[model samples]
Target: MGLFSRKKEIMVGNICPKCNMEFSEPQRTLRHIEKAHKSKKKFECNSCG
Candidate 1:
């Protein structure tokens, strides 16, 4: 028996410019960009110290 299920999954929404990451909410996409791409970490952990 050969039967194919007709199930389709589609993603249509905001996408990050820097990283092709998809987000359902536009706000989330913006936040992701600001946090991951735009913002810079001030402190860093050193193993020697």
Candidate 2:
């Protein structure tokens, strides 16, 4: 292994483009999405806009 190298993923939670909500784990957020919210819209970065 070296610097600036790709690593294995842990299947973390999905990123909300609309809001800056980040989840360290997916299970918690997945449940929240399934229960609290139904469908979510994708958002893009304003800076990248």
Candidate 3:
């Protein structure tokens, strides 16, 4: 049997633009960008903390 038996999973987060992984939080998103995507772009959200 295949490991994935259902539709693709949906994740929530700011798109890193580099790696394209969904992040649940801002900090994690930033980390992913920095560590994985190697993104220097800054992300500032007014409604998010």
C-alpha local distance difference test of each model: 0.73, 0.59, 0.65
Ten residues in sequence with the least summed lDDT for candidate 3: 8-17
Q: What is the C-alpha lDDT profile of model 2 across 1-49, one tens digit per residue? A: 4888885554545654335467666776555555556576477688986
Q: Sort by TM-score, best first: what order?
A: 1, 3, 2
Please give the RMSD of candidate 2 to the true structure.
Answer: 10.9
Identify the runs in model 2 with alpha carbons over 4 angstroms from their true place: 1-20, 39-49
**What are the RMSD figures for all models against the true structure?**
11.3, 10.9, 12.4
Off by over 4 Å in 1: 1-13, 45-49
Model 2 gets an lDDT of 0.59
- Model 3 segments beyond 4 Å from truth? 1-13, 39-49
Tell me how candidate 1 scores on lDDT.
Answer: 0.73
Candidate 3 whole-model C-alpha lDDT, 0 to 1: 0.65
Clashes of 1: 0
Cα lDDT tens digits, model 3, 1-49, are 9786996544536766565777778668776755765436477778983
Lowest-scoring 10 consecutive residues by lDDT in candidate 2? 9-18
What is the TM-score (0 to 1) of candidate 2?
0.32
Best-performing candidate as measured by TM-score? 1
